[model samples]
Target chain A: MTSLILYTPSGVLAKGGPLKLAAKRLKKLGFDVAIDEAALAKHLRFGGEDDVRLEAIHRVARARPGIALATRGGYGLTRLLDRLDWSLLAASVEAGTRWVGYSDLTALQMGLLAHKKAPTWWGPHACDDFGRDELDEVTPDCFAEAMTGALEAVGFRTESGFDGLDTRGLMWGGNLAMLCSLLGTPHWPKVRGGVLMLEDVGEHPYRVERMLLQLHQAGVLASQKAILLGAFSDWKKSPLDRGYTLKTVVAHLRSLVNVPVLTGFPFGHVPTKVTVPFGVKGHLVVQGRDAFLGWDEDHAHHHPGHDGHGHDHDGHAHHDH
Target chain B: MTSLILYTPSGVLAKGGPLKLAAKRLKKLGFDVAIDEAALAKHLRFGGEDDVRLEAIHRVARARPGIALATRGGYGLTRLLDRLDWSLLAASVEAGTRWVGYSDLTALQMGLLAHKKAPTWWGPHACDDFGRDELDEVTPDCFAEAMTGALEAVGFRTESGFDGLDTRGLMWGGNLAMLCSLLGTPHWPKVRGGVLMLEDVGEHPYRVERMLLQLHQAGVLASQKAILLGAFSDWKKSPLDRGYTLKTVVAHLRSLVNVPVLTGFPFGHVPTKVTVPFGVKGHLVVQGRDAFLGWDEDHAHHHPGHDGHGHDHDGHAHHDH
Candidate 1:
């Protein structure tokens, strides 16, 4: 049984019920879940005071559990980025501790990539995805298999125009807003020719377009082989937005950049998100309307000069066809 | 007679009533006001298509109006930054045109600063301010005085802390979100030891803090002389935010950086906003809870190698005490 430690590193966990339920479910899934002492701690809107949360993170990293999962994601990790112990987290990664979560967790994952070239997972949060009244069938299954090294490829149905689109690059990116927030910062990972994945919730289409345009204008899109757009859900349409919609936003983005912008990846602030490795070399292939992102663990382990820490360390490594 | 042009550069003007009313009010304030040809044009949510808006910007620059005021600010100018003719706009600035507006206009203003070292104004829009059903007396008065070079300073009350404090630097910045969007982009203005002013509407405190943290972590705040925070309005309180407020956000920011963070600047998306120069050398003085920002036009005019386009050309020029 793999040991998993659940902690709250971001927003305040309002109630303990969801966390308990999540632990129960994760335990049933053979996670051997152990909740952190400050998992239910609160400081205003954060899980704990800045120092407390920071300590909890270092604690989890020191424990070197098989999985270090966040209870939920709201708005806190960016604050901890400057003071975080990256070496400790990276050492834990070397010890086979798979840090998993998305949303606010993007900050940590991106920081690890920028500082130590370590990989993390873009997957479900404990409270948000696993602690639901009813468990999502695909989320936990995908997460468990990925943790156990049994899952290699994840496929989804994207828009049609990318039928012959076969490309390989470092897989990176998470919540669109979180990614934008790290721009120009020391924690920003300078990954070129990478397949960027992005998703967001509650952001209007115009806001989404603005963020994408920021990435585009900053020349991030041009450096990438492909741009994978996941779910941009929970946005409200304004009365002033006559014909302006997400479709139009995507069309405008496509017109602006030469990079292939593929949509409809199963991820984001949605329930059925796939567990994808954040810093792994991924091979993306498109057949008709179906898209697949696959990675080889053996190749990842043999990365040059890396300690073979369960995932690829070099984001610049090219996959030989 | 000073010539002013009212044009729609960003969001669509759903109704013509506000534009007409704004024009009438500006004319009453003893200026020749001309509404742009496509002031009322609509394309989805923008004032016009990208080319249309871009052409309108160049058109306004060619006209060399005393003031080129945006009709409104929503979400469109970021698209036109790459295509904008910076030299033409700089020539217009040299010819005595004062470009003005806040919110989305921050993109255009910051671009001018980055590309041509030209100054713009962080001021009002047509619809949201002057065209209100009940006009704000202070807003129009400040605009008129700032336009004719009659107003040397604007003062406001702030929390008592920095009495007898005096500092001078280049005055810059506008809407917070717009400023953050330009980070890591070519449009970003690299201003050091400058007074950075910021404000935003409808963004939660946590979001605002995250953006501020991005700036901080990117080494932006550490280089600034002082930070002037204006009104951050219209954000709703969530049940999860027990005691998390803008006050707490400011406190957190102050703890992270040694720079003085002063509040109560009379700007932002409010009715009673003061028109401030965006790229001019400003002298900031504080005495007993009262703060004043003053600029000398003569000093701004004699800048080295600069045509002295009504504002300072160099953001790095230190003010001799």
Candidate 2:
């Protein structure tokens, strides 16, 4: 097994010793693991130097041609994304190095997708992803497939009795704030006909609705065949927000677009986070309360993890493997 | 002068005694003023039941006949944007009811633009834009011109040595978060070849950068001809992200696309905010230290608000006007 290069662009992992644990865990994965100590220190000290962060990325990508994943999300990658050598990074991606992370890691994911058109995942870090005992198999399978270049299947399945919507296009979107932050810049991708999956954590319903409004006004939400509602974890309401919730946000989305809008996706900042690859062409078909993910119109034999071909009120299509 | 109507969608204003102050100031515009008290109360009390909020908009739109603006930047319009009886609202707009405000007000702007294709401005609100003495002539002029169709003669002067950018399309965009809030929904308008202007207040530079990154990844950022940075007031950094600033964020944009990028344009949560009309085609050119705004490639003028651009090494083509 190759080594894992851990980076903390946001300074989250650096502060609480998440860095040390990350390094040790990756080491157990069977290869030499390294943490960008200087970069971590810089973030821990002064907090925002793209140079240190970039150096870390380059060094890891150069030395270990395997995987580069963020440990936790705080809030610094956006400040450095544009300045990073994206072209070289793109070349590097083509040269075969996988990048991973979620939450604030969305900074890197959005930029990579926009600037380099590189494929990435809307999944979890090693700590949250593999650290759990009851870890969902879907995420791990997807991760393994991507890392090992065995990701041939492109499908998802919904629960029984779930309302289904069918969509065919390249996948786009992840965290709401990350998506909102990229408006009026070169990093937000144009999702004319896309399987736009969205989720959030800790945001009030009104805030989520506002971000969704931005996507619609910017034309990013238009012309899509289906809308996928991913897992929204721990979203809160301010005392002043007057009881609005994500349920209202969902009803609002369904009210606006004729496209089949489905909710209950399990791929976001949750414990059972699924590794969803951005910038890949795929199809989503909703049959009653179930949804099936597939590469084409026929989603017969293949199952999309355990959550396929069922009536999933939560918007996830469960399929029997 | 006509008194302005104060419309509150979130209803938070119902508790504040100053609600009358907003009405009083707009009354100074030499016209009778009124507040949508019922709608304001309902929006704040019941939340997304925008029936009252929409009624407020319609009432002011019908009664005032011009510049139907929002009272504050909170979270209600996204829920109300679609349900607001936009076709009736469009008829009112055609009869000349101009709407304004940034932040959450972006929903109204986008709704008006997408449904009616009306030109809407990123103007100030009751507390900031309307009722303040620090208001400048340039702002009211831009807002006035766009509303009255006198945008041609209300010409903008470029900063000296600011040769300005070269291009054209409708200018669109608003609060970074508000725009992104509308993603995967129907409210976002298609922005193409237009100048994508953005600004925010009290957000981390990294956060701002992430929102921008998200837009780019969603494919929303590529279609714009130029990227305009509006006034970002008091947008500071966390101790965790001390070194990275908005400047670093701009540098990232500069390193990305060849499109003309100009900073320091006035919009967002600032005292001296300018009103930008979305859905209208226009051109934005930035040459060296100066920037120009025009309708198409045919005409080019200096950026209206600055005095001899080049405030810092940051390519901020702004003037005090």
Candidate 3:
């Protein structure tokens, strides 16, 4: 059977209920899910002390499971970036480990990209998605297909003015605030001509605009092949901001940068989010308002000569990039 | 009489009451204050649109007054940074115009330092300080003294364990968030072996820790002679954090970087604040928990031959460094 480890590399899990619920669900779905012993440890809003979280990450690398999924994402991994063993984590990926999660996981994923060029999944976490009152059909199916190498491309309807637009480059980005925090740091990925996607929660439109402008000033946004905007939810409007909204932010950015910023990217702090293989080479084609991100089936290789598990992989599967 | 221009380069003044209050107070103190016409102009939340604000900056440069005091600092200068004429502002400074303010003004001051090695003041804004119901004696005296070149030194008490510590470097930094926002951007000052002072309002201890760590990871903290921390006020505590306070953050950072972090800086959102000259060569001396920052007379210069405003310039003034 496909084996996965639920690791806590960020904020502490408040209760064990969600984790238990996720493990039961994943097991019922015919996967062996093991929770790291220290996953529930709490220390002042963090998963644990820095050393504890660092140990969890190193543990997953040593185990080299088929999937190493994060238990949750909050704010912790950025503290451990400088001390992480990037090569060991990359070696795990080379041995068929597919690291998965989003939100605060952006730091680790981007750090891996900057340090090792390793591929990671920008997808659902254990508790947030599967542990819900009723698990969403889309998220699980996407996660399962992605983990088993049966998924390739995901499509979404974007705004108009992008018809006949086609570009190909490596896919990277998550949580806008986290991505911008890496700017000018060693953890920042130097991905020129790459498809950059971003999403966030609980940040007002003005703050969002501020961050985007920082990237613009740093020449990061313009360096991208295409800008994919995901969900920016859970932000409250301020009384100070009259007539300014997320739409205004997008319009302002569009006026500044020379890149096509396509909205409606179905990812980030949401229930029905899609799994994205970050740092994987992909093709972006926009036909009118409809866009698809895909990769070549033969070129999208996970690992060579893997000791096959119960997770099935069809080499003939095609992805629309 | 000492002449000052109340310029609104960031947020709108929201009311003319504070401007009038500050102007009256300054005139009573033997100074002539002129309020910028665009100070109250509101374009959404900013004082004006990018071009309008940019024009205001250029106008201030051309009109080189004794002091260019920002009416208030909320958030707007970062937008017009890429388009700012740094040489013009530097020329204005060289002509004896002392640019003053803190918080969001960190961007403008740091940008000037990075681009032209120009000096600016890290101090209170017009509305926040002079417009208050009753002015604190220390604040106005400090401002008056700094502007008149009568104030050569400001002293404060710091924590123990730093007695007998003596170090000297260029004085830099203000408003932690604004400083971090400029990180990885061209505007961020690449100051080496500098005495960096920081303060902020409404940012929790964890957020403060994260920004500090970002600077640390970027090799910023270790390059400093010493880190002078000012007020971190008005942030609410999260129950999720078990006893993790700003003190905890400082202790954690001290363990990571090998730099003396002295607290109790009487600056920031508080009423009783001191004026600091950014980009000035100064000395830091610690004596049994008491510290003083001072500069020399002949070595201290403000733009060559400043036709000397009515503000007193004894030239024999000695600052406590």
Task: Please list the C-alpha lDDT of all candidates, in the order they appear.
Answer: 0.86, 0.61, 0.84
Q: Name the 10 consecutive residues with the lowest summed lDDT in model 2 chain B.
A: B306-315
How far residue B110's Cα lies from its native spot in candidate 2, in Å, is: 7.1
Candidate 3, residues B55-128: lDDT per residue as tens digits?
88889889998899998998789889999999999999888888999988999999999999888888878998
Cα lDDT tens digits, model 2, A81-151, are 65677777666666556677787777677777788787665656755555444555556555544444434
**Could you tell me which 10 consecutive residues in candidate 2 chain A have the lowest summed lDDT?**
A295-304
Identify the candidate with maximal DockQ. Answer: 1
Q: Please, what are the lDDT tens digits per residue for candidate 2 over residues B206-252?
A: 66766676677556677778787876677544665545678777777
Worst 10 residues of 3 chain A by lDDT: A307-316
Write one digit per residue (lDDT tens) for candidate 1, span A1-321.
Answer: 989999999999999999989999999998888999999999999999988899999999999998999999999999999899999999998888889999999999999999999988889999998899987777887787777766667777789989989999998999999999999999999999998999999999999999999998888998998899999999999999999999999999999889899998887998888888888889888889877777765432322332212111111122222
Which runs in model 1 stand beyond 4 Å of their true positions? A299-321, B299-321
Interface RMSD of every predicted model, in angstroms? 0.6, 5.0, 1.3
Would you list the clashing residue pairs of candidate 1? none
What is the per-residue lDDT of model 3 for residues A183-213, given as tens digits with 9 covering 90 to 100? 8789999898999999999888877888998
Evaluated at residue B227, the lDDT of candidate 1 is 94
Q: Docking quality tier of candidate 1? A: medium
RMSD of each: 5.5, 8.4, 4.1
Candidate number that wins on lDDT, 1 or 2: 1
DockQ values, each candidate: 0.78, 0.23, 0.61
Question: For residue B191, what is the lDDT in candidate 1?
Answer: 94
